[model samples]
Target: MHDFDFVRPQTVSDAVRALATPDAQALSGGQTLLPAMKVRLAAPAVLVSLMHIPDMVFVRADGDVLRVGGATTHAQVAREAAGAYPALASLAARIGDPAVRSRGTIGGSLANNDPSACYPAGVLASNATIVTDRREIGADDFFQGMFTTALEEGEIVVEVRFPIPDAARYEKFIQPASRFPLTAAFVARHSGGARVAITGASESGVFRWHEAEVALTSDFAVQALDGLAVDADGMIADLHGSSAYRAHLAGVMTRRAVAAIV
Candidate 1:
């Protein structure tokens, strides 16, 4: 890794202050950032670690929402959020192997906004609120596209508030080697309606399968999705899977998620 100064801040405000400096980047978990640094894909002059910030690591359940601090580790979410939000917890449990899970933070995941990452699907499906140091951004507005978000420079994700769904499930078709999804679906049924979010398949990044959501909202069952199809026009196509294959998987996974929840 290139030479850089590292600072661990004890509070969100402090971390924000540190990140305000030119060429300084916020560090959380280091799962994505450190690897990039080592490969010289990213080279920030200063690494401002958010892990030590007290307000950025915890899990709590409010009336109908599960609140997770940004710096909270996947393992922590897996254990702490199980009772309050089992489906989301399950998603966290399946993110990566033990080592990656232990180190990766939800904030980092969402901030990086990798198209294949799992949290975007869950957060979007749940219509969660992303609380940043600057303001609260709705999940719908938070994720702009692949590896992109609404966060401005130096803004820190303080917390994420996920509304506890009546029933929800995340189904992933893993690539096995990387453990990232070849295609995945997160289905959440609320009192008002249902939401279906697809990840790991779209070229534009994670997106809602609105047709499936409409059908599922009308009838929350596997049979509700009988004729629904995921369009392949904008799906990711590569060696692992074709756009058509991933599109097909998106439908299958969404059906599986509905089946589990129903």
Candidate 2:
């Protein structure tokens, strides 16, 4: 990483002001940022660390929302919400083992918006609210594309808010090397409906599967989605697997997630 001005602001307002410049970047868990920086892909002139902010590393239920702060690590999520949000907690626990989970934050995962990451699918399926310093975003609007999101420059994600669902489960096919999901599925069934979201398949990034959703929505049974096929047009091709293989895994994981939820 190149030499940069490091600002450890204690307040959200200060962090916002500090990141007002175009070259400034927010540093959360540094799980992705540090690696990207090492590869010389990220060379921010100023790095604003969100760790010092009070309440930015917490997880609790407020009103009807399960709030998880941006700086809150995956280990924290796994510990705090493990029983409450089983699927989300399971996903957090499976995030790069004990060491990475200890360092990787929920906010960091959301901020990086990696196409292959677990949280996006979990958030979307759980109908979570992505609360930023500026505003709140619906899960659908939060994720945009590969390494991209709805986050504006200088606008940082402060926390994530998820509504309690009736039941939820996550199933993933992880790549042996990086451990990122080759294809991951998050399924949540509430009084309203059942949502199914897939990660690590699409080129444009995380997306909800409407087909499997239809089956789960109609009948929450695993066998209900027997022949449902995931559309592969939007999926990405990679060395880990072909587009066809990933699309197949998307359906396989979708069924498995539905099974796990029930």
Candidate 3:
């Protein structure tokens, strides 16, 4: 491993200071970072570890929002959030293996914003907030591209606030190798209308499936999801799943998600 300054800050302010550097990298569960470092893929001059911050690992339900701290692990969310938002909790339970769940954090996952990741879809459908010391970014604006986010330098995700929905479900077909979603859907019943977010299908990363949303909004039924057209342009095309296959699965999983919720 390359020698570098490893800073473990106990507070958000300290973390911010550590990240003020031009080449500082935020460390969350180290699921992605450590491996990259081992292969010399990433060589950050300063490693700012967020794990020691006690205040960033809590979960609470306040009125209409379910606020989850950035350091909260998937396993932690799986156990604590199940009773309140079963869909999200179940989604957390299904991310990666048990080891990954135990250490992989929401903040890290959101910061990484993998194209096939699960939380982005759920957050988008739930209309969640990606809270940071700098600003609170809406789900629609937070995620920008594959493995990229709207997070600026020195900005760290403090928490995620998901608006509690009436009903919700996340369904996906996991690619066996990496366990990334080949195509996934998160469907929710909100006050304005039914929301359906699709991930793993598009090169633009996770996005709301408007075609599927339109069909479900009209009838809010599984059968209504039939004949929905998902745009194949700029979709993910890889060895695991073709762009067309992922597009088709987006519709299928969307209907399945709707069925699961309704």
Best by TM-score: 1
Give the Å error, residue 203, model 2.
Answer: 0.4
User: Which regions of candidate 1 are displaced past 4 Å?
Assistant: none
The count of backbone overlaps in candidate 2 is 0
- For candidate 2, the C-alpha RMSD (Å) to the true structure equals 1.2
lDDT of 1 by residue, 1-262 (tens): 8989999989888888999899999999999899999999999999999999888899999999999999999999999999999999999999988899998999999999999999999999999999999899999998898899999999999999999999999999998998988899999999989999999999888999999989988888888888889999989999999999999999999999988887
> Candidate 1: worst 10 consecutive residues by lDDT?
219-228
The C-alpha local distance difference test score for the whole of candidate 3 amounts to 0.89
What lDDT tens digits, residue by residue, belong to model 2 across residues 8-95? 9998899999999769999987888999899899999999998889868888877756888888999989999876777788899888
TM-score of each: 0.99, 0.97, 0.97
TM-score of 1: 0.99
Candidate closer to the true structure by lDDT (higher is better), 1 or 2? 1
lDDT of each: 0.94, 0.88, 0.89
Candidates 1 and 3 compared: the better one by lDDT is 1
Expressed as tens digits, the lDDT of each residue in 137-182 for candidate 3 is: 9998998888889998879899999999999999989987888788
Candidate 3: how large is its RMSD? 1.1
